[model samples]
Each structure stands twice: as structure tokens, then as C-alpha cells.
Target: MSYQRRLHPNLHMETDSQIKQPSGRWGQRTAYTKAPNITDILAELKLGHRVTPVFAHRSYTWELQKMLRARPRPVFDLCYLDGGHSWDVSALGVFLADRLIRPGGLLVLDDLDWSIATSPAFQEGPETLGQFSSDEQQAKPVRLLWEEVLPDLGYSHFAIHPNLGWAIARKRDTKAVVPAD
Candidate 1:
């Protein structure tokens, strides 16, 4: 969620020479970090009268499963997956989101454009079928998988936020049939 950079002073100065003092904060103190912007989503959820936060990491699915299993039912009102950029990880995230989200819940995927629109492996083979053109392909599998999974999950309403490469998917209460006898 955050990144820090460090800078060191040059070591070419002579022992008797006066070294230039660094301005403002020094060393690690000068490092800066930023938090992801989730304020609007949090506010919207509050307005909708929902509480409880279910945080899941795409790369840490096992840990997530363990945590969710230890908790009560309807664990998450909204799930956002932005950890793993790989197809396998993203797909697993979608699957877990389906399991965790209650009827009428919401799910969000972050960095979708970067992951899907630039991965070489995803531009070929099983990852790419009939959905997008060669020039319009994305590197992440979620871009393609969501189309099939959302409807199957009974999410009737979905919207993509302009300019943020973020998408919001809403699960509906429509009865979904299992493909079995």
C-alpha cells in the first residue's frame, strides 16, 4: 500500500572539509509514505448502513481463508482485491469474493488496467479468447473472468469508475441455479 525511498550523502568530501547538512528531515526521517484512497468507498458504505471490513489479499488466499473461517457468517459486505496481479491470483480472489460476499454485497478490483492491459502471458492462449481485440487485450485474467463470474454470481449491477481503473460490482439476490441434476 506504500513505498519509501532513501537517499544517502556523497562520501567524496575530505575529512577537514565541511560537509553540507541535509535540509529538513534526515535519513529515514526524510522518507515518505502514502495511504490508498478509500475514503469515498468507506463513506458510501456508511451511508448504505453497512459495517464490518473484510480484507483479503489475492496473494495470501490461504491466510484469508483461515481468517474468514474463524469468523462469523456474512464476513464481508465489500471485498477489494488489489494484491496479486497474476491471473491465477486474481481468479482466486474472484472466487473468494463470491464466497465471502452476501447477497447485495459489493466487490472491487484495483489496478485492473495495469494488470490486465499489459501482461504478456494474459495476451495469449487460454487467457485470451473472444472478448477483446489484440490491441484491446489486458494482461490480467479478471478482465475476462469477471464477465462470466459476475452474471453467475447474480450481480446485476456493475460500474467502472472513470479514470481510476477501478470497478465496482454489486451482487443481486436473484436465484442462481447450480449446474447439477
Candidate 2:
């Protein structure tokens, strides 16, 4: 988002400019690095008031649901899913994002091939061991969602970059099509 802002300094996030962070059960990850607060990072980037910071009191899913309920129509143009690589969280996040994003909107899912079992930061820790099963630890949840879930949902035009470990797909337009007779 900061990079996008750099390219288009006047860009506004509009209604969904709020930054949603994790909380509760989903927030119990062992931090391998001390990262700066997102709001501070955004502020440092001079993202300004256009970017509202809303920390999740529960989970990102809960906050997204609330946003969905408040809005009568799809508004966001893009949604980046990079947190909570587990199926329990990421899957539902994408589902809600489908409703939140407008037709033809971009949905970027990061760490497509990332698995807890292979993560250098988490592989040795109890977080990877006790929190996930052997299969879950080895499985790529983002990749599964990208291949199996998005196609069934209303997304197309995929661009999967394995080297970069990210996938981009556009939400399908829901307009009616006139078939040739």
C-alpha cells in the first residue's frame, strides 16, 4: 500500500482504508523479529489520515465481517491477504474479501508456497509443532485457496509467481452475458 501511495500520492483508500491487524486466538504467534507498529510505519510513509488504523480486538475475520455488514455494496478495489497462513483464518478472510471487493478487483495472496514446516523462523519452534499437524505444517494453505477455492468463487485471470511466492487473481464481473443464438 505504501508503494502504491508513492506512485500515486493522491490515492485514497476511501471507506476501507483502515488497517486490520490480528488479535485473540489468531494472534498467538511467536515473533521472530521486532516489527514496527503498522500505523507508525504508514505514518512514516506519510500515508496520512487517508489510511485509518483499526486494530482487531478479536480476529481479522471478525473485523472484516463488521465492515461487510456496515457497507451495502462492494467498495474495496484490492485486498492483500498475508497474515494468518492457516486455513482456519486465511480461507474465511478470502471469502469475506470476495464480498468486500468490487468486480474485477485485485486480490493478492502472499506466500503461496510457504509452509510452517519449511519456515526457518518457525520450523524449530513449538508454534509449528503444537499448533499444526504434520500435513498442515507441510501444506501450502494459500496455494490451496488460490487453486481450489478462488476458481469456484468469482475470480479469474491468475498470475502465480512461484519464485516470488505470490499469486494475483481478479474477481470476476457478475454482469449478465448475452449468449449467441
The TM-score values for the models, in the order shown, are 0.53, 0.68
| Per-residue accuracy of model 2 over 45-112 as CA lDDT, tens digit each | 78766655555554678878898888475477788666567787889989988888888789988788
**What RMSD, rounded to one decimal, does every model reach?**
15.0, 6.8
Point to the candidate with the largest TM-score: 2
Clashing pairs in 1: 116-138, 116-139, 116-140, 117-139
Summing lDDT over every window of 10 consecutive residues in candidate 1, give the lowest-scoring window: 11-20
- Evaluated with lDDT, which candidate comes out highest? 2
Q: lDDT score of model 1?
A: 0.52
**Each candidate: what lDDT?**
0.52, 0.69
Give the C-alpha miss distance for residue 7 in model 2, angstroms: 13
